[model samples]
Target: MERALKRYWPIFILPTLLAFLIGFIVPFVQGLYLSFCQFTTVNNAKWVGLSNYIKVFKDTTFTDAMKFTIAFTVVSVILINVLGFAIALALTRKLAGTNIFRTVFFMPNLIGGIVLGYIWQILINCVLSIVGEPLLALNTQAGYWGMIILTCWQQIGYMMIIYIAGLQNIPDDLIEAAQIDGASSWTTLWRIKLPMVMPSITICMFLSLTNGFKLFDQNLALTAGEPYHSTEMLAYNIYNTFYARAGAQWKGIGQAKAVIFCIIVVAISMIQLKATRSKEVQQ
Candidate 1:
Protein backbone atom coordinates (compact mmCIF):
# COMPACT_ATOMS: atom_id res chain seq x y z
CA MET A 1 0.00 0.00 0.00
CA GLU A 2 2.82 2.41 0.88
CA ARG A 3 4.71 1.75 -2.39
CA ALA A 4 1.57 2.08 -4.49
CA LEU A 5 0.54 5.31 -2.76
CA LYS A 6 4.03 6.80 -3.08
CA ARG A 7 4.17 6.01 -6.80
CA TYR A 8 0.71 7.54 -7.43
CA TRP A 9 1.22 10.66 -5.24
CA PRO A 10 1.71 13.05 -8.16
CA ILE A 11 -1.40 11.72 -9.89
CA PHE A 12 -3.50 12.59 -6.84
CA ILE A 13 -1.76 15.95 -6.28
CA LEU A 14 -1.54 17.27 -9.86
CA PRO A 15 -5.18 18.32 -10.25
CA THR A 16 -5.27 20.20 -6.94
CA LEU A 17 -1.89 21.84 -7.67
CA LEU A 18 -3.06 22.98 -11.12
CA ALA A 19 -6.31 24.35 -9.73
CA PHE A 20 -4.48 26.26 -7.01
CA LEU A 21 -2.07 27.85 -9.48
CA ILE A 22 -4.84 28.87 -11.86
CA GLY A 23 -7.28 29.96 -9.21
CA PHE A 24 -5.13 31.62 -6.57
CA ILE A 25 -1.42 31.96 -7.35
CA VAL A 26 -1.82 33.58 -10.76
CA PRO A 27 -4.59 35.93 -9.63
CA PHE A 28 -2.66 36.90 -6.50
CA VAL A 29 0.45 37.80 -8.47
CA GLN A 30 -1.63 39.69 -11.03
CA GLY A 31 -3.33 41.64 -8.22
CA LEU A 32 0.03 42.76 -6.77
CA TYR A 33 1.19 43.97 -10.17
CA LEU A 34 -2.06 45.82 -10.78
CA SER A 35 -1.71 47.67 -7.46
CA PHE A 36 1.11 49.77 -8.92
CA CYS A 37 -0.80 50.57 -12.08
CA GLN A 38 -3.75 52.88 -12.74
CA PHE A 39 -6.70 51.44 -14.64
CA THR A 40 -10.41 51.15 -14.77
CA THR A 41 -10.05 47.52 -15.82
CA VAL A 42 -7.50 44.72 -15.89
CA ASN A 43 -6.45 45.13 -19.53
CA ASN A 44 -6.11 48.92 -19.48
CA ALA A 45 -3.94 49.25 -16.35
CA LYS A 46 -1.07 51.78 -16.60
CA TRP A 47 1.91 51.94 -14.27
CA VAL A 48 1.56 54.85 -11.79
CA GLY A 49 4.30 54.14 -9.16
CA LEU A 50 3.53 55.10 -5.52
CA SER A 51 0.82 57.61 -6.29
CA ASN A 52 -2.06 55.29 -5.40
CA TYR A 53 -0.53 54.53 -2.04
CA ILE A 54 0.08 58.22 -1.44
CA LYS A 55 -3.57 58.91 -2.19
CA VAL A 56 -4.64 56.14 0.15
CA PHE A 57 -2.76 57.71 3.05
CA LYS A 58 -3.74 61.24 2.07
CA ASP A 59 -7.44 60.48 2.30
CA THR A 60 -8.62 61.38 5.79
CA THR A 61 -11.56 59.05 5.31
CA PHE A 62 -9.17 56.15 4.84
CA THR A 63 -7.33 57.08 8.05
CA ASP A 64 -10.61 57.30 9.96
CA ALA A 65 -11.67 53.93 8.59
CA MET A 66 -8.42 52.40 9.76
CA LYS A 67 -8.87 53.78 13.27
CA PHE A 68 -12.49 52.70 13.43
CA THR A 69 -11.71 49.24 12.08
CA ILE A 70 -8.86 48.67 14.54
CA ALA A 71 -10.97 49.80 17.46
CA PHE A 72 -13.91 47.62 16.46
CA THR A 73 -11.72 44.58 15.89
CA VAL A 74 -10.06 44.97 19.30
CA VAL A 75 -13.31 45.30 21.23
CA SER A 76 -15.14 42.64 19.24
CA VAL A 77 -12.33 40.14 19.65
CA ILE A 78 -12.37 40.50 23.44
CA LEU A 79 -16.14 40.32 23.76
CA ILE A 80 -16.51 37.34 21.42
CA ASN A 81 -13.87 35.29 23.21
CA VAL A 82 -15.03 36.10 26.73
CA LEU A 83 -18.71 35.56 26.02
CA GLY A 84 -18.00 32.40 24.04
CA PHE A 85 -15.87 30.99 26.82
CA ALA A 86 -18.44 31.84 29.45
CA ILE A 87 -21.21 30.17 27.48
CA ALA A 88 -19.00 27.17 26.89
CA LEU A 89 -18.43 26.84 30.62
CA ALA A 90 -22.15 26.92 31.35
CA LEU A 91 -23.09 24.51 28.59
CA THR A 92 -20.47 21.98 29.65
CA ARG A 93 -22.40 20.96 32.75
CA LYS A 94 -24.92 18.12 32.84
CA LEU A 95 -27.86 20.19 31.71
CA ALA A 96 -31.11 19.11 30.08
CA GLY A 97 -31.41 19.60 26.33
CA THR A 98 -27.83 20.78 25.90
CA ASN A 99 -27.91 20.05 22.16
CA ILE A 100 -31.05 22.13 21.70
CA PHE A 101 -29.57 25.01 23.64
CA ARG A 102 -26.40 24.91 21.56
CA THR A 103 -28.38 24.80 18.34
CA VAL A 104 -30.46 27.79 19.39
CA PHE A 105 -27.40 29.83 20.29
CA PHE A 106 -25.47 28.83 17.18
CA MET A 107 -28.35 29.58 14.80
CA PRO A 108 -27.40 33.22 14.63
CA ASN A 109 -23.98 32.39 13.24
CA LEU A 110 -25.50 30.41 10.41
CA ILE A 111 -27.44 33.46 9.25
CA GLY A 112 -25.91 35.61 6.52
CA GLY A 113 -24.07 38.75 7.65
CA ILE A 114 -26.21 41.05 5.51
CA VAL A 115 -29.37 39.52 6.87
CA LEU A 116 -28.10 39.80 10.42
CA GLY A 117 -27.21 43.44 9.85
CA TYR A 118 -30.71 44.34 8.68
CA ILE A 119 -32.34 42.23 11.36
CA TRP A 120 -30.33 44.00 14.03
CA GLN A 121 -30.86 47.42 12.46
CA ILE A 122 -34.63 47.07 12.60
CA LEU A 123 -34.53 45.90 16.21
CA ILE A 124 -32.16 48.64 17.32
CA ASN A 125 -34.00 51.36 15.44
CA CYS A 126 -37.28 50.25 17.01
CA VAL A 127 -35.82 51.05 20.40
CA LEU A 128 -33.91 54.18 19.36
CA SER A 129 -37.00 55.58 17.65
CA ILE A 130 -38.34 56.73 20.98
CA VAL A 131 -35.41 59.18 21.17
CA GLY A 132 -36.25 60.57 17.69
CA GLU A 133 -33.28 58.84 16.06
CA PRO A 134 -32.46 55.66 14.17
CA LEU A 135 -29.63 53.13 13.67
CA LEU A 136 -27.55 55.33 11.33
CA ALA A 137 -28.27 58.51 13.25
CA LEU A 138 -25.66 60.80 14.87
CA ASN A 139 -22.08 59.66 14.09
CA THR A 140 -19.68 56.74 13.79
CA GLN A 141 -19.45 56.28 17.55
CA ALA A 142 -23.06 55.16 17.65
CA GLY A 143 -22.52 53.00 14.59
CA TYR A 144 -19.39 51.57 16.19
CA TRP A 145 -21.29 50.35 19.26
CA GLY A 146 -24.11 49.01 17.11
CA MET A 147 -21.60 47.10 15.03
CA ILE A 148 -19.92 45.69 18.13
CA ILE A 149 -23.22 44.55 19.60
CA LEU A 150 -24.20 42.99 16.30
CA THR A 151 -20.86 41.20 16.01
CA CYS A 152 -20.93 39.84 19.54
CA TRP A 153 -24.49 38.59 19.20
CA GLN A 154 -23.70 36.82 15.94
CA GLN A 155 -20.22 35.39 16.57
CA ILE A 156 -20.15 34.48 20.26
CA GLY A 157 -22.07 31.27 19.75
CA TYR A 158 -19.71 30.00 17.07
CA MET A 159 -16.73 30.62 19.28
CA MET A 160 -18.65 29.00 22.12
CA ILE A 161 -18.72 25.75 20.14
CA ILE A 162 -14.95 25.81 19.85
CA TYR A 163 -14.57 26.35 23.57
CA ILE A 164 -17.04 23.59 24.30
CA ALA A 165 -14.99 21.14 22.28
CA GLY A 166 -11.89 22.17 24.19
CA LEU A 167 -13.68 21.74 27.49
CA GLN A 168 -14.88 18.27 26.56
CA ASN A 169 -11.39 17.23 25.51
CA ILE A 170 -10.10 17.79 29.05
CA PRO A 171 -9.71 14.56 31.03
CA ASP A 172 -11.90 14.01 34.08
CA ASP A 173 -8.97 12.45 35.94
CA LEU A 174 -7.12 15.78 35.93
CA ILE A 175 -10.01 17.60 37.59
CA GLU A 176 -10.42 14.85 40.16
CA ALA A 177 -6.72 15.00 40.93
CA ALA A 178 -6.85 18.75 41.39
CA GLN A 179 -9.86 18.49 43.71
CA ILE A 180 -8.21 15.80 45.75
CA ASP A 181 -5.27 18.08 46.27
CA GLY A 182 -7.56 20.60 48.08
CA ALA A 183 -7.62 22.97 45.10
CA SER A 184 -10.71 25.17 44.96
CA SER A 185 -12.82 25.77 41.86
CA TRP A 186 -11.16 29.12 41.18
CA THR A 187 -7.69 27.62 41.37
CA THR A 188 -8.69 24.70 39.15
CA LEU A 189 -10.22 27.05 36.62
CA TRP A 190 -7.24 29.39 36.53
CA ARG A 191 -4.66 26.64 36.39
CA ILE A 192 -6.14 23.60 34.72
CA LYS A 193 -9.25 24.45 32.69
CA LEU A 194 -7.83 27.60 31.15
CA PRO A 195 -4.56 25.95 30.19
CA MET A 196 -6.39 23.04 28.62
CA VAL A 197 -8.60 25.39 26.66
CA MET A 198 -5.73 27.50 25.32
CA PRO A 199 -5.89 25.79 21.95
CA SER A 200 -9.53 26.77 21.56
CA ILE A 201 -8.75 30.29 22.78
CA THR A 202 -6.04 30.61 20.16
CA ILE A 203 -8.35 29.48 17.38
CA CYS A 204 -11.30 31.64 18.51
CA MET A 205 -9.07 34.70 18.87
CA PHE A 206 -7.66 34.29 15.35
CA LEU A 207 -11.08 33.84 13.77
CA SER A 208 -12.72 36.74 15.63
CA LEU A 209 -9.73 39.00 14.93
CA THR A 210 -9.62 38.25 11.20
CA ASN A 211 -13.39 38.39 10.82
CA GLY A 212 -13.56 41.67 12.71
CA PHE A 213 -11.01 43.29 10.42
CA LYS A 214 -12.62 41.95 7.24
CA LEU A 215 -16.24 42.70 8.16
CA PHE A 216 -17.86 44.38 5.14
CA ASP A 217 -21.38 43.21 4.45
CA GLN A 218 -22.71 43.95 7.92
CA ASN A 219 -21.04 47.34 7.93
CA LEU A 220 -22.43 48.11 4.48
CA ALA A 221 -25.93 46.89 5.18
CA LEU A 222 -26.17 48.45 8.61
CA THR A 223 -24.69 51.90 8.14
CA ALA A 224 -23.02 52.21 4.73
CA GLY A 225 -20.71 54.60 6.54
CA GLU A 226 -23.46 57.19 6.61
CA PRO A 227 -23.27 60.66 8.14
CA TYR A 228 -20.24 61.61 6.01
CA HIS A 229 -18.40 58.27 5.98
CA SER A 230 -17.88 58.49 9.73
CA THR A 231 -18.68 54.78 10.20
CA GLU A 232 -16.70 53.57 7.21
CA MET A 233 -14.42 50.64 7.93
CA LEU A 234 -11.37 49.46 6.01
CA ALA A 235 -13.30 46.96 3.87
CA TYR A 236 -16.12 49.41 3.06
CA ASN A 237 -13.58 52.13 2.42
CA ILE A 238 -11.88 49.90 -0.14
CA TYR A 239 -15.21 49.03 -1.72
CA ASN A 240 -16.22 52.69 -1.99
CA THR A 241 -12.89 53.48 -3.60
CA PHE A 242 -13.20 50.57 -5.98
CA TYR A 243 -16.73 50.93 -7.35
CA ALA A 244 -18.77 53.79 -5.94
CA ARG A 245 -16.67 56.59 -7.39
CA ALA A 246 -16.14 57.07 -11.14
CA GLY A 247 -13.12 58.16 -13.27
CA ALA A 248 -10.81 57.87 -10.26
CA GLN A 249 -8.59 55.11 -11.66
CA TRP A 250 -10.38 52.77 -9.29
CA LYS A 251 -8.76 49.39 -10.00
CA GLY A 252 -5.13 50.13 -9.07
CA ILE A 253 -5.95 52.15 -5.99
CA GLY A 254 -8.36 49.48 -4.75
CA GLN A 255 -5.79 46.78 -5.39
CA ALA A 256 -3.14 48.77 -3.52
CA LYS A 257 -5.47 49.28 -0.57
CA ALA A 258 -6.28 45.57 -0.62
CA VAL A 259 -2.60 44.58 -0.62
CA ILE A 260 -1.84 46.89 2.29
CA PHE A 261 -4.89 45.63 4.15
CA CYS A 262 -3.78 42.05 3.64
CA ILE A 263 -0.28 42.78 4.92
CA ILE A 264 -1.60 44.58 7.98
CA VAL A 265 -4.04 41.79 8.86
CA VAL A 266 -1.40 39.09 8.36
CA ALA A 267 1.14 40.92 10.53
CA ILE A 268 -1.41 41.53 13.28
CA SER A 269 -2.58 37.90 13.25
CA MET A 270 1.00 36.66 13.47
CA ILE A 271 1.74 38.97 16.40
CA GLN A 272 -1.44 37.90 18.23
CA LEU A 273 -0.68 34.21 17.72
CA LYS A 274 2.84 34.70 19.02
CA ALA A 275 1.75 36.72 22.04
CA THR A 276 -1.06 34.33 23.02
CA ARG A 277 1.01 31.19 22.29
CA SER A 278 3.70 32.27 24.72
CA LYS A 279 1.19 32.23 27.57
CA GLU A 280 -0.46 28.91 26.64
CA VAL A 281 0.36 25.94 28.86
CA GLN A 282 0.28 22.24 28.12
CA GLN A 283 -2.19 20.09 30.12
Candidate 2:
Protein backbone atom coordinates (compact mmCIF):
# COMPACT_ATOMS: atom_id res chain seq x y z
CA MET A 1 0.00 0.00 0.00
CA GLU A 2 2.83 2.40 0.84
CA ARG A 3 4.68 1.56 -2.43
CA ALA A 4 1.46 1.99 -4.45
CA LEU A 5 0.70 5.30 -2.82
CA LYS A 6 4.20 6.62 -3.50
CA ARG A 7 4.36 5.31 -7.08
CA TYR A 8 0.88 6.54 -8.05
CA TRP A 9 0.80 9.72 -5.91
CA PRO A 10 0.41 11.97 -8.95
CA ILE A 11 -2.59 9.98 -10.16
CA PHE A 12 -4.28 10.34 -6.77
CA ILE A 13 -3.38 14.02 -6.46
CA LEU A 14 -4.22 15.09 -10.02
CA PRO A 15 -8.02 14.76 -9.79
CA THR A 16 -8.27 16.62 -6.52
CA LEU A 17 -5.75 19.25 -7.72
CA LEU A 18 -7.83 19.83 -10.85
CA ALA A 19 -11.03 20.02 -8.83
CA PHE A 20 -9.46 22.55 -6.45
CA LEU A 21 -8.30 24.71 -9.33
CA ILE A 22 -11.80 24.65 -10.78
CA GLY A 23 -13.72 25.02 -7.54
CA PHE A 24 -11.53 27.24 -5.41
CA ILE A 25 -8.26 28.64 -6.76
CA VAL A 26 -9.73 29.91 -10.01
CA PRO A 27 -12.69 31.59 -8.31
CA PHE A 28 -10.51 32.92 -5.49
CA VAL A 29 -8.11 34.63 -7.88
CA GLN A 30 -10.99 35.97 -9.93
CA GLY A 31 -12.80 37.22 -6.83
CA LEU A 32 -9.72 39.11 -5.68
CA TYR A 33 -9.42 40.68 -9.11
CA LEU A 34 -13.12 41.59 -9.04
CA SER A 35 -12.60 43.41 -5.73
CA PHE A 36 -10.68 46.16 -7.50
CA CYS A 37 -12.92 46.42 -10.57
CA GLN A 38 -16.41 47.67 -11.25
CA PHE A 39 -18.64 45.44 -13.35
CA THR A 40 -21.98 43.66 -13.36
CA THR A 41 -20.18 40.57 -14.61
CA VAL A 42 -16.68 39.19 -14.27
CA ASN A 43 -15.97 39.38 -17.99
CA ASN A 44 -16.75 43.10 -18.07
CA ALA A 45 -14.85 44.18 -14.96
CA LYS A 46 -13.49 47.74 -15.38
CA TRP A 47 -10.63 48.44 -13.03
CA VAL A 48 -11.42 51.12 -10.42
CA GLY A 49 -8.45 50.26 -8.19
CA LEU A 50 -8.74 51.46 -4.56
CA SER A 51 -12.03 53.32 -4.96
CA ASN A 52 -14.08 50.33 -3.81
CA TYR A 53 -11.85 49.82 -0.80
CA ILE A 54 -12.19 53.47 0.08
CA LYS A 55 -15.95 53.21 -0.24
CA VAL A 56 -15.99 50.21 2.03
CA PHE A 57 -14.32 52.19 4.79
CA LYS A 58 -16.44 55.26 4.15
CA ASP A 59 -19.69 53.41 4.62
CA THR A 60 -20.79 53.83 8.25
CA THR A 61 -23.08 50.82 7.91
CA PHE A 62 -20.09 48.65 7.12
CA THR A 63 -18.29 50.03 10.15
CA ASP A 64 -21.29 49.26 12.33
CA ALA A 65 -21.40 45.76 10.92
CA MET A 66 -17.76 45.27 11.75
CA LYS A 67 -18.33 46.40 15.32
CA PHE A 68 -21.39 44.20 15.71
CA THR A 69 -19.58 41.23 14.24
CA ILE A 70 -16.59 41.60 16.54
CA ALA A 71 -18.75 41.96 19.62
CA PHE A 72 -20.91 38.98 18.60
CA THR A 73 -17.79 36.91 17.95
CA VAL A 74 -16.26 37.68 21.34
CA VAL A 75 -19.42 36.82 23.26
CA SER A 76 -20.15 33.72 21.21
CA VAL A 77 -16.61 32.33 21.41
CA ILE A 78 -16.51 32.59 25.21
CA LEU A 79 -19.94 31.07 25.74
CA ILE A 80 -19.47 28.31 23.18
CA ASN A 81 -16.04 27.20 24.38
CA VAL A 82 -16.66 27.53 28.12
CA LEU A 83 -20.10 25.94 28.07
CA GLY A 84 -18.88 23.23 25.73
CA PHE A 85 -15.91 22.34 27.92
CA ALA A 86 -18.17 22.26 30.97
CA ILE A 87 -20.64 19.95 29.29
CA ALA A 88 -17.78 17.75 28.10
CA LEU A 89 -16.54 17.50 31.68
CA ALA A 90 -20.01 16.53 32.83
CA LEU A 91 -20.49 13.94 30.11
CA THR A 92 -17.03 12.43 30.57
CA ARG A 93 -18.10 11.32 34.02
CA LYS A 94 -19.44 7.78 33.98
CA LEU A 95 -23.06 8.84 34.25
CA ALA A 96 -26.24 7.08 33.16
CA GLY A 97 -28.04 8.48 30.06
CA THR A 98 -24.98 10.47 29.07
CA ASN A 99 -25.31 9.35 25.48
CA ILE A 100 -28.91 10.50 25.33
CA PHE A 101 -28.02 13.91 26.77
CA ARG A 102 -25.17 14.34 24.32
CA THR A 103 -27.43 13.40 21.41
CA VAL A 104 -30.06 15.91 22.54
CA PHE A 105 -27.47 18.64 22.93
CA PHE A 106 -25.81 18.05 19.57
CA MET A 107 -29.08 17.69 17.68
CA PRO A 108 -29.53 21.48 17.60
CA ASN A 109 -26.27 21.85 15.69
CA LEU A 110 -27.57 19.65 12.85
CA ILE A 111 -30.58 21.86 12.25
CA GLY A 112 -30.42 24.27 9.29
CA GLY A 113 -29.32 27.80 10.19
CA ILE A 114 -32.40 29.32 8.59
CA VAL A 115 -34.71 27.04 10.55
CA LEU A 116 -32.94 27.80 13.79
CA GLY A 117 -33.17 31.50 13.08
CA TYR A 118 -36.91 31.39 12.57
CA ILE A 119 -37.43 29.20 15.61
CA TRP A 120 -35.43 31.55 17.80
CA GLN A 121 -37.17 34.57 16.33
CA ILE A 122 -40.54 33.09 17.15
CA LEU A 123 -39.48 32.21 20.67
CA ILE A 124 -38.02 35.64 21.36
CA ASN A 125 -40.98 37.41 19.82
CA CYS A 126 -43.35 35.36 21.97
CA VAL A 127 -41.59 36.64 25.07
CA LEU A 128 -41.30 40.23 23.80
CA SER A 129 -44.96 40.37 22.76
CA ILE A 130 -45.97 40.43 26.40
CA VAL A 131 -44.34 43.86 26.62
CA GLY A 132 -45.90 44.91 23.25
CA GLU A 133 -42.92 45.19 20.95
CA PRO A 134 -41.13 43.06 18.33
CA LEU A 135 -37.64 41.68 18.85
CA LEU A 136 -35.78 43.97 16.46
CA ALA A 137 -37.68 47.01 17.70
CA LEU A 138 -36.35 46.33 21.18
CA ASN A 139 -32.98 47.83 20.09
CA THR A 140 -29.39 46.90 19.22
CA GLN A 141 -28.79 45.43 22.69
CA ALA A 142 -31.57 42.92 22.24
CA GLY A 143 -30.39 42.01 18.73
CA TYR A 144 -26.84 41.56 19.96
CA TRP A 145 -27.79 39.37 22.90
CA GLY A 146 -30.24 37.39 20.77
CA MET A 147 -27.58 36.58 18.19
CA ILE A 148 -25.10 35.62 20.93
CA ILE A 149 -27.57 33.27 22.55
CA LEU A 150 -28.50 31.73 19.24
CA THR A 151 -24.87 31.16 18.28
CA CYS A 152 -23.87 29.67 21.66
CA TRP A 153 -26.88 27.36 21.83
CA GLN A 154 -26.17 25.95 18.40
CA GLN A 155 -22.39 25.70 18.69
CA ILE A 156 -21.77 24.44 22.27
CA GLY A 157 -22.82 20.86 21.64
CA TYR A 158 -20.51 20.40 18.65
CA MET A 159 -17.65 21.92 20.63
CA MET A 160 -18.52 19.68 23.61
CA ILE A 161 -17.90 16.55 21.53
CA ILE A 162 -14.46 17.87 20.60
CA TYR A 163 -13.62 18.65 24.24
CA ILE A 164 -14.91 15.26 25.33
CA ALA A 165 -12.60 13.53 22.86
CA GLY A 166 -9.72 15.62 24.11
CA LEU A 167 -10.53 14.82 27.72
CA GLN A 168 -10.77 11.08 27.06
CA ASN A 169 -7.42 11.05 25.27
CA ILE A 170 -5.58 12.37 28.37
CA PRO A 171 -3.75 9.24 29.60
CA ASP A 172 -5.02 7.85 32.90
CA ASP A 173 -1.41 7.54 34.03
CA LEU A 174 -1.08 11.33 34.02
CA ILE A 175 -4.14 11.73 36.29
CA GLU A 176 -2.81 9.11 38.66
CA ALA A 177 0.58 10.81 38.75
CA ALA A 178 -1.07 14.16 39.48
CA GLN A 179 -3.13 12.54 42.22
CA ILE A 180 0.00 11.06 43.78
CA ASP A 181 1.42 14.58 43.92
CA GLY A 182 -1.61 15.56 46.08
CA ALA A 183 -3.04 17.81 43.39
CA SER A 184 -6.62 18.98 43.82
CA SER A 185 -9.18 18.64 41.05
CA TRP A 186 -8.87 22.30 40.05
CA THR A 187 -5.11 22.17 40.14
CA THR A 188 -5.00 19.06 37.95
CA LEU A 189 -7.50 20.55 35.51
CA TRP A 190 -5.55 23.77 35.14
CA ARG A 191 -2.05 22.25 35.14
CA ILE A 192 -2.41 18.76 33.68
CA LYS A 193 -5.74 18.27 31.87
CA LEU A 194 -5.75 21.64 30.17
CA PRO A 195 -2.17 21.37 28.98
CA MET A 196 -2.83 17.91 27.59
CA VAL A 197 -6.00 19.09 25.84
CA MET A 198 -4.43 22.13 24.22
CA PRO A 199 -4.92 20.56 20.79
CA SER A 200 -8.63 20.22 21.39
CA ILE A 201 -8.81 23.72 22.82
CA THR A 202 -7.15 25.05 19.69
CA ILE A 203 -9.59 23.21 17.45
CA CYS A 204 -12.63 24.37 19.42
CA MET A 205 -11.41 27.98 19.59
CA PHE A 206 -10.68 28.06 15.85
CA LEU A 207 -14.03 26.53 15.02
CA SER A 208 -15.92 28.98 17.23
CA LEU A 209 -13.90 31.99 16.12
CA THR A 210 -14.16 31.26 12.41
CA ASN A 211 -17.82 30.35 12.63
CA GLY A 212 -18.57 33.52 14.59
CA PHE A 213 -16.76 35.70 12.08
CA LYS A 214 -18.29 34.10 9.00
CA LEU A 215 -21.81 33.71 10.32
CA PHE A 216 -24.55 34.67 7.82
CA ASP A 217 -27.53 32.36 7.36
CA GLN A 218 -28.78 32.68 10.92
CA ASN A 219 -28.01 36.42 10.96
CA LEU A 220 -30.05 36.83 7.80
CA ALA A 221 -33.05 34.72 8.85
CA LEU A 222 -33.13 35.98 12.45
CA THR A 223 -32.47 39.74 12.31
CA ALA A 224 -31.86 40.51 8.63
CA GLY A 225 -30.04 43.50 10.17
CA GLU A 226 -33.46 45.04 10.57
CA PRO A 227 -34.86 48.11 12.41
CA TYR A 228 -32.62 50.55 10.55
CA HIS A 229 -30.04 47.81 9.94
CA SER A 230 -28.71 47.93 13.48
CA THR A 231 -27.64 44.27 13.49
CA GLU A 232 -25.78 44.07 10.16
CA MET A 233 -22.72 41.80 10.28
CA LEU A 234 -19.97 41.51 7.67
CA ALA A 235 -21.58 38.77 5.58
CA TYR A 236 -25.03 40.36 5.51
CA ASN A 237 -23.49 43.75 4.87
CA ILE A 238 -21.69 42.37 1.84
CA TYR A 239 -24.92 40.75 0.66
CA ASN A 240 -26.88 43.97 0.98
CA THR A 241 -24.14 45.98 -0.73
CA PHE A 242 -24.26 43.72 -3.77
CA TYR A 243 -27.98 43.10 -4.11
CA ALA A 244 -30.15 45.32 -1.92
CA ARG A 245 -29.17 48.70 -3.30
CA ALA A 246 -29.25 50.20 -6.78
CA GLY A 247 -25.92 50.44 -8.68
CA ALA A 248 -22.80 48.54 -9.66
CA GLN A 249 -20.70 50.69 -7.30
CA TRP A 250 -21.91 48.87 -4.21
CA LYS A 251 -21.29 45.53 -5.93
CA GLY A 252 -17.63 46.32 -6.40
CA ILE A 253 -17.49 47.68 -2.89
CA GLY A 254 -19.08 44.50 -1.57
CA GLN A 255 -16.46 42.42 -3.37
CA ALA A 256 -13.74 44.49 -1.75
CA LYS A 257 -15.38 44.02 1.65
CA ALA A 258 -15.53 40.27 1.12
CA VAL A 259 -11.86 40.12 0.16
CA ILE A 260 -11.00 42.11 3.29
CA PHE A 261 -13.13 39.78 5.40
CA CYS A 262 -11.34 36.76 3.93
CA ILE A 263 -7.97 38.24 4.77
CA ILE A 264 -9.04 39.11 8.32
CA VAL A 265 -10.46 35.65 9.05
CA VAL A 266 -7.48 33.82 7.52
CA ALA A 267 -4.95 35.98 9.35
CA ILE A 268 -6.69 35.57 12.70
CA SER A 269 -7.03 31.81 12.28
CA MET A 270 -3.35 31.46 11.40
CA ILE A 271 -2.25 33.54 14.41
CA GLN A 272 -4.50 31.54 16.74
CA LEU A 273 -3.26 28.23 15.32
CA LYS A 274 0.37 29.28 15.82
CA ALA A 275 -0.23 30.48 19.37
CA THR A 276 -2.13 27.36 20.45
CA ARG A 277 0.12 24.88 18.62
CA SER A 278 3.08 26.08 20.68
CA LYS A 279 1.29 25.18 23.92
CA GLU A 280 0.08 21.71 22.91
CA VAL A 281 1.70 19.01 25.07
CA GLN A 282 2.89 15.65 23.80
CA GLN A 283 1.07 12.60 25.14
Winner by lDDT = 2
TM-score of every model versus the real structure: 0.96, 0.97
Model 2 ranges off by over 4 Å: 132-134
Tens-digit lDDT track of model 1 for 1-283: 9999999999999999999999999999999998999987788889999988888888788898999999999999999999899999989997998899899889999999999989887777777777766556554566888899999999999999999999999999999999999999999999899998898889999999999999999999888898788889999999998888787477677888999999999999999999888878766
Residues 75-180, model 2: lDDT tens digits: 8999999999999999998899999999999999999999998899888777777887666654677777888989988999999999999999999999999999
Whole-model Cα lDDT of every candidate shown, in order = 0.90, 0.91
TM accuracy, model 1:
0.96
Question: Least lDDT summed over 10 consecutive residues: which range in candidate 2?
Answer: 133-142
The number of clashing residue pairs in model 1 is 0
